[model samples]
Target: MNILFVHGNYPAQFVHLAKALAADGHRVVFLTGRKDPEVWPLTGVEVRRFELHREVSSEIHPYLIPMEQAVLQGQAVLRVLDVLAQEGFQPRLTFAHGGNGLSLFIRHLFPETRLIAYMEWWFRDETSHWCFPSYEFDQRLRTTMRNSIILQELEQCDVAVTPTSWQQQQFPKHYKDKIKVIFDGVDTSFFCPTPVKGELILNGLKCVQPLHIGENSLLLTYATRGMETLRGFPEFMRMLPPLLEALPNLEVVIAGDDRCVYSQAPDRADGSWKQALLEELGNRLDLGRVHFTGSLMYGEYQQMLNRSDLHVYFTRSYVTSWGLFQAAACGASLMVNRDPATNYVLKGDQAYWVDLDDPQHLVDCATKVLKSAPERRKNIKQSYLKSEWALGNCIASWVELINAQLKV
Candidate 1:
């Protein structure tokens, strides 16, 4: 089988599947954006980086920024596919992340090939619009227009794949039949709660005094790619003072960068959202016990999940985060937000759900979860192990789907 995976970032959602196919003797090649060659050294897989021929104009409408960027990047990918075709290369199947328009026009290039756009989210005129609570008429109009790019790509691709049912439900009813709900499975073996026997160190910290996690201390972990409003970082920070005040031995480890990934909340005139929180909660929080590991290595992150007494994950009624699944896989007692229709993972005593609007309730819920015995939280971990989202299972399902598409 000749398989080609396309994503601007190398091996993002396709990592496990690509590696598995290559190991199974399938010819696997990746078309990625300009990334460091040394970073991706996957054996049995060929990696090729494509360069954008042009850039999105600065004077273009602000609403069309993402669409414009995707067009440029998509053109670059098409050029690479053209070169490969000239060299007698034809992929039986191609998988791409729909956010970028990489697979938007692939059908025109290789009519015989099967292209599956891995649709994460389709930002349409809905309740989950980015400019919520502070919605502006102009912003809403802009968002409505942003769907053009996604709609065009959705039509161009042979099929679509979404990681969650909530995400798949976001698509229009007409396209629902063609969309498949397949999660990017978690590697339970690497993420399991095998207690670490040694001390762990975080990035941007001196090694002279490495932090000894999972020691005789009550640990609470909150992790995300960016500490932005979409993930409810601001409210979580505000609730932390009361939580820290309640538990004297509690140690909080926050893992992420100080950048805004979502939301149009104006940054503080002086610094970031994190800095603003630090200023507002000065002396109120136990500074010694609160550690911020800017970004962590995979090993460090796994240890944080496995070692924590309780892991807190909060998100709006939007796309779900992979961190929640990873936390569950690591056997951590989960404290998550109740987003009603969006959060389907908190059923059957798997996680403690808190109200999205109440900071006091969050503090009370987390504090109680921290005090609860580890034996009571075994259900959360056991539920995850028995699920269908394990890495091997997802890869097999993905291969089967691709093979089925090729047959047609």
Candidate 2:
């Protein structure tokens, strides 16, 4: 089967799937706007890059900012499609990452091609309005217009894939029937618990605590794109002051780069609530205890997760982060907010549930995990292993799902 993968970045979610398909003797071609073309090179896969304009308005108006982004992305897609036609490369099936305007253009260019869109989010919920809250006053009007574009793309696709059931359920009733759930798998090899080398310098303190087989550590980790609002960074920061008072030795390490993740709009600049909370905690919380490692390479990220005793995974709405799965794969006891999406992946006694809006609850749950017995910690680790959230298993499942959809 000839497959063409379309995404702003080359091999983003399709890395493992692309390799598996190529290994199975299928031809694959990737169309991406990634600056580093050398990053993707599979034996049976060819990659092409298209220059994309990614500028956005720094204005206070939320609607204008996103509108600017959409326009730039749409223009980029049009250019890529023209190049593909001239090159005479027509793929039998096209896989696209939904939400990007590229998928809609693919449908327009190849009207007969069977396109399967990876539907990460539908932006249909009321909470979706909160994602761009600066436009809240005109949310109803904006949502209707934005969703119309998404629905049009959905109509063009032959099928769609959703990572989690929570995300799939968010689609319109008519489109839900065509959506299939296939989770983004973990790489268990890199994420599992390993021997610690030296004291990792967090904030300023040198934490050298060891996990004796089943014992938990005084460390807590939150990894994601560092947007203060979207990933609940502000709420996590607010809960930290009280949490530090309760557990002084407790260290919080936030991973990911701020520039790439956080919006730079003038309105969003004031979203530095995390820095403020850290300042208030001051030396009382151990200035060295709150560490931000910026963005880490994949290897370093997994190593940090391996060192964590407890991982705090919080999000405002339904979207799930890959960090949550990687932490679980590493056997880190997780404290997640009560959300339907996270509930599906972590169940029973494996995860502690907290209300995202309640800072006190987050503090209490962190304390519980820190004080839990080694035996209890061991049980949680076993639960993660038993659920087959391991990387190898996840990769295998992904291969099966994509292959099943192939027209072979």
Candidate 3:
């Protein structure tokens, strides 16, 4: 079967699925706005880059900018689809992400093509970032308005896919039947635990290295695509000083970019959350022990997760991060929040949970994990192995779902 995949960030959640289809001798083509060839390079798939020409009008209201940008993206994708259709490249099915409005006008171009919309997250007035402590009323109002695009795209899709049941339940009851629960999957083989050889590598160099596993050194890791409050970045930073002071052997490695990819997070005069934490914590923090390794390559990230003594992950009731699953796959001990979003993946017995409202709780959890024996970390990993989110298992599920979708 011929398949067309559309995503602003192509091959993101669809990487395993796309490659699996290509391996099965199916012709797979991806239409994406992503320009980073390094990131989107798939050996068997044909990739086409689409450009957005319409810039946000200065005269337009601030609240309308998001909707306008999405509409422009939809327009750009529509143009690419038209070209593909003219070239006799009509796909039997098109998989798109509803979050970015990519599939908004796809049906108009090819009414017969079945479309499966990927519902990553739904932006609602209340459940979204509005629930965050620092969210503003104006931002909430704008977000509520911005949700129309997703609603429209969801309405148009033949079916929808969500990585988690928690995320699928976020949609309205009317749309629940169409939203299938599927995990993006974790590569357990690549992320397996490594014997601590008493060293850490960063960009091919070891600056903040640990010599011994438990006696002379400690390895704690936290990672996200971005450093933001939704993932508990600020709160994590607040918890760090106490942990650093309590455990002198501690070495914290934070992997993420400075920008907030999800929503606007609180920033300092210099506009960096990291710098703000540095200023607030001041001499209280052992800066020398902290290593901020901004976004890493996939191999590097897996290696870091494998070496981590404890992987700390905290998130709101919103979308759960892929990092959590990766850490679990790596057989690393987890320190996660007790929020319902995380409970779906990390059971209470599988991970150490702390009350997100209290920064002290986070510190306590970290200390507890650090003090625990190194052998105990395997429990969390064992629990994750039972999950169907393992790489091959997830790809098999996707293939089954796609086959069913293609059935006449």
Candidate 4:
């Protein structure tokens, strides 16, 4: 069987599924805008690189800019598609990650092949997105326009899938039935707890040199791809000073780059939220015990998770962060923001939750958990194995879903 995949970033969410297909003796062709193949080279999958030869005009209206970018991306992908079509290549299935317009014209060429869209999220309303406010009419209009491409793809595709129930619920009521919740499974065995915990090593961030956490040191972890307000970086930072003052033995290990993706820059010269927060809480924070390691390798991350006395995470209502789930898998006790998404996985005594509005409450919760929550580590692991969200189980379901679509 010939299977085609369309993603701007190759193997973003398709890592496990693509490898599974290739191992099953299927020819997997991937179309991506990723320039460097060495970064992630799947053994059997053939990756085709597409170049965006044109750019969206600066003069274009703000609301139309997103669609313009998608159209340009779609045109670049179309060029690649045209070549494949001429070469007598007809895939049995085309799996596309929606949001980008790359796969917008895919079905036009391969009319017989079934198209399946990987639905991440749709900006259903202002409340659904953490950054937007419902009262902001202009921003809401722009967001509604942004969803046009995704809606088109969703309407046309044979199947559409979102990673979580929360994300699935974010779509329109009419389209809710069309979207299925298929989580991007977590590898429990790989992320499971490590028994050895003696020393902590941080690869080092550009802004902060890492501090050492000895054998007896109590470690607190915060991991994310970027230090953004949407994920509660600022609120988390505010809790750090007071939490450190309370516990002298506590050592902090922060994992992630000092970049913002979902939120605006801080009101500072450098615009780094990390730098701004540090400046804001300057002498109050004990620099000796706090460590900031930009982006950790998997081995380092796993070790930190295992060693973490309390792993603090803060994500908005609809957004899903894999780091939290990994922390859960590693039996890391969580101190997270109070949101339905986090509450979904970490409930009851599994995690220590606090609202972003009250930094003092976060400090209070962390202090209590650090002093007493020894058994809470195991509590989260039990519920979160989401046995259904386990890699093997979900992969099997993916195979079944893909094969089922092929038959239709």
**All models, RMSD in angstroms:** 2.6, 4.7, 2.8, 2.5
Instruction: Decide which is better by lDDT, 1 or 2.
Output: 1
lDDT of each: 0.78, 0.68, 0.79, 0.81
Candidate 1 residue 306 C-alpha distance from true site, Å: 1.4
Report residue 93 deviation for candidate 4 (angstroms).
Answer: 0.9
Full candidate order by lDDT, most accurate first: 4, 3, 1, 2
What is candidate 3's lDDT per residue for 89-160, written digit by digit as tens? 888989997877788888898888889999977776556763454658887787777778888888898888
Per-residue C-alpha lDDT of model 4 across residues 1-408, encoded as one tens digit per residue = 889989999788988888889988999999999898667789899999899888889999999999999988988888998998898889999988898898888878889988889988778554445763232778778888989989888988998988888788778889887787787888887988666445776665443544467867777889888897778888888888888888888888888988887656776678798988898899999987777777777887888887788888888775688888788877677877777777777656767777878877888888988876455444434424567777888898887888788778
> What is the TM-score of each predicted model, taking all chains together?
0.91, 0.82, 0.92, 0.93
Q: Which stretches of candidate 2 lie over 4 Å from their true place?
A: 37-44, 53-72, 132-135, 193-217, 246-248, 259-273, 279-285, 373-380, 383-408
- Using TM-score as the measure, the top candidate is 4
State model 2's lDDT: 0.68
Worst 10 residues of 2 by lDDT: 204-213
| TM-score ranking of the models | 4, 3, 1, 2
Report the Cα lDDT for residue 187, model 3. 75
Give lDDT: candidate 3, residue 264: 64
Residues 1-408 of candidate 1 have per-residue lDDT tens digits of 788899888777888888888998989989989478547578798988889988899999988987888888888988998998898889988888886678776777888888888887777655546435466777777777667777887887888899878888888889998898888999988988766544445553322355665455678888987777778888888878888888877888888888776664455574477887888899997878888877777888887777777888988767788888888787777888888433676565777888869888888888788877445434444435447778878877787888789789
Which stretch of 10 consecutive residues in model 4 shows the poorest summed lDDT? Answer: 376-385
Consecutive 10-residue window with the lowest summed lDDT within model 3:
204-213
The better candidate by TM-score, 1 or 4, is 4
Best by lDDT: 4
